[model samples]
Target chain A: MLTLAGVGKRYRRRSVLAALDLALARGEIVGLLGPNGSGKTTTLRIAAGYAWPDSGEVRLAGEVFDPDQATLRARIGYLPERVPLYDPFTVGEYLDFVAAARGLHGPSRASAVARVIAAFELDAVRTRVIGRLSKGFRQRIGLAQALVGEPDVLLLDEPTNGLDPFQILEARRMIRAAARGRGVIFSTHILQEVAALCTRVVYLHEGRLVELAVDGRDAGLEVRLARASLDAVRARVHALDPAIELRSAEALGEDRHRLVFDLGRAGVARAELVRLLAEFADLESVGEATPDIEQALNAALAAQARGAAA
Target chain B: MRGFVTLFARELRHYFVTPIACVVIAVFWAASGFFFSFNALFVAAPDMVSAFHNMSLLLMLMMPLVTMRTLAEERSGDTLELLLTLPVGEAAIVAAKYLALLVILVLMLAGSTLAVIPLALYGTPDYGPILGGYLGVFLLGAAFAAVGLAASSCAANQVVAAVLTWALLLLMWFVDYAAALDGAGGAVRWLQHVSFSVQYLDLIRGVLTRGAVVWFGSVIAVGMVVATQVLRARRA
Candidate 1:
């Protein structure tokens, strides 16, 4: 639903984003994964029409987006990283103001405010001043205001940054629910969040965009076994499929070791390897592996470093 | 237009909800009351010429207080991002804030009219000059409000905004005196042409010249445009 074509941004003599291109489609939750100063926030700000890119254009639904056209730009909702809010305003009042600012009026405005309050579970503190609320509540209100206008596109910067684990889960659910008919582009440093919540993910490094290619056929598995039997387990896995490669092996305290395997290049099913290892070692646990976000990130950065060196 | 109306209303509501507006309004009323009562009871003046003069000066000093937080607070509190991304243009945002400050000025000016009641009761005050004086002060307040908003847009904090506004208004107010110096020449005459005191005194003396009207109009326009441009430059 939104696209940034050859977008570039520079501050003084330094470039923050260079010839970056991205497209977000309806119902797609694209997680912008990058470390600090990776231009993720800059990309979101440009897409939200809050800032002008030094080069290229931003298009919404096939039309070049114009920041001056209030009515047309209201179709996209944005939540900055700081969660811009008026401390003096109550939760309901703030939502009402945002709803009206988006051009909704009278009954529609009231309904929009009420709908988001209910959706984000803000009814409890509806009348409390935002400044007096806790960080978690304030974050929820920020998310609520962005969704109050029911815009077609949502741009959120670290939407779950300050929330606790449960609150983060709630925020993730709220974001997923809000994405039914809208496109979402959210930035964050948490890899697990991207893995759990995103339909697609892209990493940004040194002002360049890199999309993580995940083939449906290739998978990863984690096996926990007695430490002494790790070598036996490895030998058996290679015997089954010589193409299988051990990504990493870590000791689990005194007796057990946890081994991660890249099942991508192997024809052997993970179940067969687990059963064969169980006969020789005391198998503690076996399950699909969570994508090692840190490992992947380090590899990507290292590859970029080598390319620069070459 | 919808965004402008909503923001305008929200700003107006905030002025009442916060303590700063109440304090400013209270201080204005108390000081203006003192000026009027001192003029009537102590100075034994039957006319409102001096009262309007004092009121005009009071507005010049208080307008910065009224407008200091309009844009400066948004910038400091980080709400300007939310505002900029909302489909509202920079011009509309500035206009809405300016209009809200104008409404406060209108209320204060309207309340000051109550002081004229004693003049109508005991003294045979000429209604024409009194009416002209009210118009004069309103225009002066309008010009002050605009300058204050411009200062708020440029400054990093409210105190700096207020100080910048005070410096600018005082310069405009004193330019007339500077033009009367012994060595003053053609350039000084040009400076006097833009002197706020000179234009404002004309309206107080019941001389509604086109030059004076245009002077205030230009000041208001320049202030609004400067404030709008500051917002635009930040986005760029």
Candidate 2:
């Protein structure tokens, strides 16, 4: 398990991460969804104890709070975005190095390396240099290294970034297997991957926490976020504006549900709808209306350009 | 400590698995062999100090090649993140790398000692200066490797690391050139204090002065700390 509390980071004059909080528990595979520069990688880096945050602390397994402690970092396995590797070392050698570096020695180290090689299905290319492998194999090897030490927490940045569909499937399978007894949190831009693999999803926007949703049914959105209950949110919304009509409501789960409004009967303004949803459900993003990340980024960039011209 | 040794082993493996280490060792052996045969090893003074000095200079040239990729390649290749995020401290990472470079230097230095074989067979080779020269060159190699490690820590790539290391070593070579200048002052004294070759020459003269030992020791210590700080800066 891992928890990041009030974590923030700034590079020079640019604020890369605002006050953010995230908690991931064992057996939970959460996907951090965000566009580029959304502080997803920074957050993950801080959680992995690779980067020290300007203001905040990361606690692993609830008790080990100091990121400066080297031994505490052993409980974490991180796969950076680029999947940095020594090209000349073979797959087995690299994994063995990582295992030993994590404090595994002798028979234990060898078995750990062998286990990851088999788990990632890297036995075929175990003897080949990493540089000679294809991109997919390279990604798998990176994953294997992260899985080498069998750490309790896994921090992966864009594990499926450049992989093909088959490779992505294999990666997902590996990630799921890794999460069986550990806390798994990976960042990605793909929506379907989150829907298919994550039991929970956190959305970050402009370096701030935007939404946190739970996929309880393994079908629809079921999450407890905003650190509040659905009934508490509904009561707040009712207090704000009682006349807001709710045509239909469906309870997807105790914490997550769907509410439909009459759009034609009375033109509901976006502001009121947002307020109702914000107060009715502890969700930063509502209605599953986010177009793919590419389109959203384009629109934001276009707006920025227009603003610059003005 | 296990992390350091583990990382050290991996670094040694990296040096050999790539062609760089082999090329450096082979080049050193060939060049030393050529010099011992043609540079009048026995015609000059009885000792092989000059040959040893030349070997020291050769190490100055080859150390940057061995150490350039120690941290620079890690940064460029993104492996530093993977390594740093493990249960290893920044100091440990730097020490492991510098230790690996020292091991490589030992291998090459050991190979170069073969030149003394024919000297013993053909001439009355005094073992005193030879032993002293080996110690001198080995210490000199450590200083060069440390500087190379510091340079590698700051460089963006291996090529840049190599260039910067060469420049640093060259500066150390020439900084104390004016130790005997007419207006000898703070700068000259400073250079004399820091000059790597100055400290190394004492060991070649068969005298292990405290100043010489401290000079090489400081370089090894300060250079490693600088390298560790460079890596630690990333966290900030």
Candidate 3:
């Protein structure tokens, strides 16, 4: 529903974002992963129409987005990294203000505010001043305000920044639910969060975007063998399919080794591999393995470092 | 526009809820009351000319407090991002905020009207000059408020906003003396013409000159436009 085409931004002598391209479609939750000073917030701000990109254009539904166009802005909701909120306002009052600001009127405004309050389970603190609430409640309130207007696109920066474990799970559930009929682009430092919440993941390094995965699909299996050597297990796994990729093999001491293989890419059936390993070594526990986004990102960073060194 | 109305109402409600607004209003009433009593009882003045003049000076001092947080606080707290990203134009935001401050000024003016009750009861007072005096003070307050809001948009904090407002208003106030200096030239005449004190004196004296009216309106317009420009420039 939103696209940034060849966008470039510079702060005086420093380039923040350079020729970056990204697109978000409805029902897709895109997680923006990057280290500090990687232009994640800058990209969101540009998409939300709060800042102008020095070059190229942003399009919403194929129409060029203009920051000065209020109508266009109404179709997007943004939660900044700092979670902008008025401390003096109660939860209901703040939601009401956001609803009205988005052009919801009278009954509709009241209903929108009520809807988000119910959705986010903010009814208990509806009358409580936001400043007086706990950080978790305040973060929920921030999320609540962003969804009040039912904007087609939701841009959230560190949406689960300060929440506790349970709250984080709750927020993830709510965000996943909210993305059912809308597009969401959220940036975070939490790798597990991206793995848990995102349908698509992208890495940003040195002012450029890197596509990491398409749908965070289960692409492999992680198996722990009780009486197998790392080299022997690797040799046997390779024998199953010469093209099979053994992503990782670790010696766990006492003749035990853990192996992770990209079974999907290698076209090797999980049962065939298990049967073959069972004949040579004692059977051990095995489970589906989601691609380790952290490992992939570390490899990408290492590759970049090597390129720079060369 | 819906954005303007929503923002204006929120700002008006905000003024009523904030302790700083209440304190500023209270202080203004106390100062205006003291001056009114001094003029009516001690000096035995039959009109509200001096009282209105003192209230105008008091407004020049107090308006900064009323407007300091209008834009500065939002910038400092990062709520400006939320506001700008919403479907609201900068001009509408500035106008709504200025109007909200104007409403507070009206409330203060309404409270000061109580002084007229005692004046009418004790002595014969000219209602024409009293009415004109009210108009004059309202215009002065509106101009001061607009100027204060413009200062708020430029400053980084409330304290700096207030100081910048005082500096700007004092310059306008003291420019009259500069024009009155001997051997002054055409530039001084222009300064005298633009001087806030010169524009406000005629209206308080029961003469609402078109020049004074236009001058105040121009100041208000310029202030609002400048504030809007500052907001736009910050987004860049």
What tier of docking accuracy does candidate 3 attain?
medium
Put down candidate 3 lDDT per residue, B1-236, tens digits, no spaces. 53999999888888776687788888889899998887767886646788788888899988988899999998998899999999999998999999999888998888888888877898788898888879988998999999999999998799999999999999998887877677777778789888998888887786788888899999999999999999988776
What lDDT score belongs to each candidate, Candidate 1 first?
A: 0.84, 0.79, 0.85
DockQ computed for model 1 against the true two-chain complex using alpha carbons: 0.66
Q: Which candidate order results from sorting by DockQ in descending order?
A: 2, 1, 3
Per residue, candidate 2 scores C-alpha lDDT tens digits across A235-269 of 56556655443332333354254443333222456
Judging by TM-score, tell me the better candidate of 1 and 2: 1
Top candidate, metric lDDT: 3
Query: Taking the candidates in order, what DockQ does each have?
Result: 0.66, 0.76, 0.65
What is candidate 1's TM-score against the reference?
0.88
Q: Model 3 off-target regions past 4 Å? A: A214-290, B180-184
Candidate 1 local lDDT, B1-236, one digit each (tens): 54788889999999987887778777887888888897778887656777778888899889999999999999999999999988788888999999998888888877778887987888787888888888888888999999999999998799999999999999998887877787887769788888888778777655667888888989999999999999988887
Model 3 CA lDDT for position A49: 85
Candidate 1: where are CA atoms >4 Å away?
A214-291, B180-184
